[model samples]
Target: MTLYEVTGREMYLKQAADLANLCATWVVSFPYLLPPETPLARLGANLTGAVWASTQNKHGAPGFCTQSGDALFKLFRTTGRAEYAELLRDVIHAHAEGIQPNGKITERLTYCDADSRGSRGDGGKTGWNETNGALMALEIPGIYIRTDRSGMFVFDHVEASIVRQDRRKMVLKITNPTRFDATVTILAEDARKAARPLGENAHLHWKEKVMVKAGQSIFHTIQK
Candidate 1:
């Protein structure tokens, strides 16, 4: 079920209004759950083992051994969920500990030797699950740390960072992480002074909204 529906059901089941309020708080606290197309649901969903037994030998689809970790890490970072972040770390660590000198996770989940012991059907070495395990393990942590700390509410086709935030003074370092050049708008609250680009001499008249281009980075400071 979608998170909104699930939360709504929970709200209906709650006998007390205070408990219902807690559900609302949870929604605000974890925005990642609002997306219906979350990574875990996208990358990890699968049919029973019978559909994948020809290769994976276990229930669920193959080719996602370590990808799930990346999915979960993104979710954790987006939502600031401690449990999901920790689970992402645990999954990555398990793969790391099982990696051989050649950098492949040990085939057997229960295998304790230093050698890689798992089997990956006939798909060869370039399959999705082959090298992505290590790559995802290496890439997820840094992204997690950066995204978790960012307070900016990024919308579609945008990436941003809150360089500094205060009641009277706000500093933002906004970026368009996408490839194509496009216009993007940023919102500021109680901005009283003209917005100025940091590390440069450019400045805009005091405005609550700022627009930037794709792949552009701007440092802005405004007074409340």
Candidate 2:
């Protein structure tokens, strides 16, 4: 499973065009591989329904989990499939609905309405570990998004936008998506000059790191 996550995330990090094509094929073939016998077939139908529904085309549950969402995000990043991202976001929000004030999430999730209440064994605990793993490589809007044409590579979870992306410079509108202050290490390249981090104290150089406060968005720019 770890390898699957890594490969999915790497598809974005490396921005390999071939890998993007491969990921698209994988998603297309996923439905056919399910067996018609047993409960697995029903679960497969639910998942496909949820994916299709998320796109407003009309649509799964207990199959909803942080790990599953993470995989979907990777697929979205790899293939630029809006549906994949939508489904994953839907799952994340639904899973969040079941979270307790103490931060533990219930084990099962219903794909219909983001409900997080159920007892599917494991004593109602299932999200902490997978959530951490998912967010560690969460994809956000930026120039580094995989494409047939190449520009840059990005790997990290930060709610931000790319204000500019030219050959000489790359400017990012960055925000810390987490509740607490964080030091985000954006695995990137083309950093030879100083970084302009508006209202933030961190510098973003080539392959360097930056820091941001909880709920604060900063304009971070670096020259090549």
lDDT of 1 by residue, 116-161 (tens): 2122212223344556564553344321112222333443234556
Give the worst 10-residue stretch by lDDT in candidate 1: 194-203
| Candidate 2: segments with Cα more than 4 A from true spot | 1-71, 108-124, 127-158, 177-179, 182-209, 222-224
Pick the TM-score winner: 2
Which residue pairs clash within candidate 2? 46-60, 49-59, 53-59, 94-114, 191-206
Query: Per-residue error at 108 for model 2, in Å?
Result: 4.7
Candidate whose lDDT is highest: 2
Alpha-carbon deviation at 127 in model 2, angstroms: 6.4
For each candidate, give its TM-score against the true structure: 0.31, 0.43
lDDT by candidate, in order shown: 0.36, 0.41
